[model samples]
Target: MSQRIFHHPVLGSMEERTALQFQFNGAVYTAYEGETIAGALLAAGVRTLRVHEETGAPRGIYCNIGHCYECRVHVDGIPTVRACMTLVTEGMCVTAGSVLPTPLKKGGHAK
Candidate 1:
């Protein structure tokens, strides 16, 4: 899918801005500074962020707001972060929920 909204039928031309790079599932993608992580992923054509832990069903962003928890992802080793609420940062590392490793406790012990 196209990563840009050049001419919105309603909003017309979007303001131009510098782009940033972030890693999703170890692959780098370009993102705008103010866009949320879910928006960035959607712009890059990433439809699935994770699979169900038990059922293995695929999941993506839903409800765009923070309530649904359906867009949970790991950001820079921190798991369960809602992508729809988290803005993308340059060099940020994002992982799909299904492949996220078990989080560790302080002092290096696995939680």
Candidate 2:
């Protein structure tokens, strides 16, 4: 089942667009031309885009308009690209962000 809005109350029906294929976290998915990466992923049933850098908690699209950075993902080797803002293209590579290793405790020493 796709999460795309086929018919909007005000916007009416969605336009027919060319289908494009893209890779996300090593898996291939279909996206329509002019559709955002986040939109495509959501339509494909992918909710978590990345994890919190500090806590490793799952993060997905929050403010889809680009206000929140929760939808940030690596796009085509570029780090921290907003999935909601970046449009999906054919053969594009998208990698979900992962948590960074935390620093050692104040009294701890590295071996």
Candidate 3:
């Protein structure tokens, strides 16, 4: 789905935002200045964020309120950041796993 909010019955038309750039999985993408990392990724059509540390199952945003740790990702070399809670900034590096070596590839790549 397109990330642009276009129009909403309750929220109405989307407001203009200052566009910013960030890197996800080594690729640069556009994002709004105030949007969350998860929101930007989701808007960019990224459904999965990372693999389970124990089971290796694909994981994405679950609670979206920061209570659940399911949306954890590496941000600027910091591992296990809650993507849903953290806001996006220009040039932020978002990766899909912890700092330690894992079976699955980093940045949403499959094992």
Candidate 4:
């Protein structure tokens, strides 16, 4: 039940690669070598990579070429890592981004 494109009409079959293990939000998942984090997650049926910083809305891969920044996630304690651009490696830990807290004004009102 993987979402990988095994056979393409133009590109033919996908290349064989070594399988690797990675963790996303505390759960382990399998990914092939040379695959990007966003690709692996999508293959594992994970759509929502993170949430909107202010609205708390679910966010997934949009403009997956690394230009949209919607697929950003935390990797190995590093913040704002683009999942679409980062390659998946064995033992890599990935966490979904969360909504940021609202700023408060001088009188304790949200800004």
Candidate 5:
């Protein structure tokens, strides 16, 4: 039996179609143009997003609201972003990691 696919609110509520192609684990995933990486993954029913920092334990979307910082991912060569707070872009690359973040500003914002 074939199953049905589900889309998220932001993607489903759009006035027009906005399908964008991206790769995850060498496989293609289709998400709306404005959806975030984690949102896409979550909508796809993907749990256990990444690993633990030191204990190497399994980790995933702890705070679907992006407060726990457990869903950090490397997007397009940049690290330290809350996947729950970022929007997906076409041709964007994403990587998963579980290292304790350093106390430094990556983009060199004004002090």
Candidate 6:
């Protein structure tokens, strides 16, 4: 999806300027302070958030209430982090890219 997902500002007034900035898909975006990167995206109405590390399957923020594992993403340089549970930091660069290569599934091969 395009960066047009957010224009109206869901967290607060843009003029007030707690506007946190970051780059996603090469486009610069302004989110908010104290909100999780995932929360900021969701508030901006971002749909497709990331791809699976092992399968490259398209993934997004599921279980908005934060019980499901679908929202896992990489923050800074950390891996296997639950984006929904973390707080957004100013100047933080979060990339929903991939986790490390997982071990083989069953039968000595990937699932």
Per-candidate TM vs. native?
Answer: 0.83, 0.88, 0.82, 0.89, 0.70, 0.65
What tens-digit string does per-residue lDDT give for candidate 3 at 1-111?
A: 456676899999768888989998898888887899998898989988988775678899899999989999999999889999999998899999733456665467674
RMSD to the native, candidate 2?
A: 2.9
Judging by TM-score, tell me the better candidate of 1 and 2.
2
Angstrom error at residue 55, model 2: 1.6
Clashing pairs in 2: none
Native-to-model Cα distance after best TM-score fit, residue 15 in candidate 6, in Å: 11
Compared with the true structure, model 6 gives a TM-score of 0.65
User: In candidate 3, which residue ranges exceed 4 Å CA deviation?
Assistant: 98-111
Q: Local error of candidate 2 at 59, Å?
A: 0.3
* lDDT computed for candidate 6: 0.68
Q: Which stretches of candidate 1 lie over 4 Å from their true place?
A: 1-3, 99-111
* Tens-place lDDT digits, model 6, residues 8-85: 667654444377777554555667766676777776677666787777888988886679878776677786677788
Off by over 4 Å in 5: 1-14, 98-111
Candidate 1 C-alpha lDDT tens digits along 27-60 = 9999988989999899889989888865568999
Best prediction by TM-score: 4
Clash totals for all candidate models? 0, 0, 0, 0, 0, 0
Ten residues in sequence with the least summed lDDT for candidate 2: 102-111
User: How would you encode candidate 5's per-residue C-alpha lDDT over 75-94 as one tens digit per residue?
Assistant: 77787778888888777777
lDDT of each residue in 4-48, candidate 2, tens digit only: 888999999989889999999999999999999999999989999
Evaluate all candidate structures by whole-model CA lDDT and list the values in order. Answer: 0.87, 0.93, 0.86, 0.93, 0.71, 0.68
TM-score of 2: 0.88
Q: Write the per-residue lDDT of candidate 4 for residues 1-111, one digit (tens) a residue.
A: 788888999999988889999999999999999999999999989999999987889999999998999998999999999999999999999999898877864457644
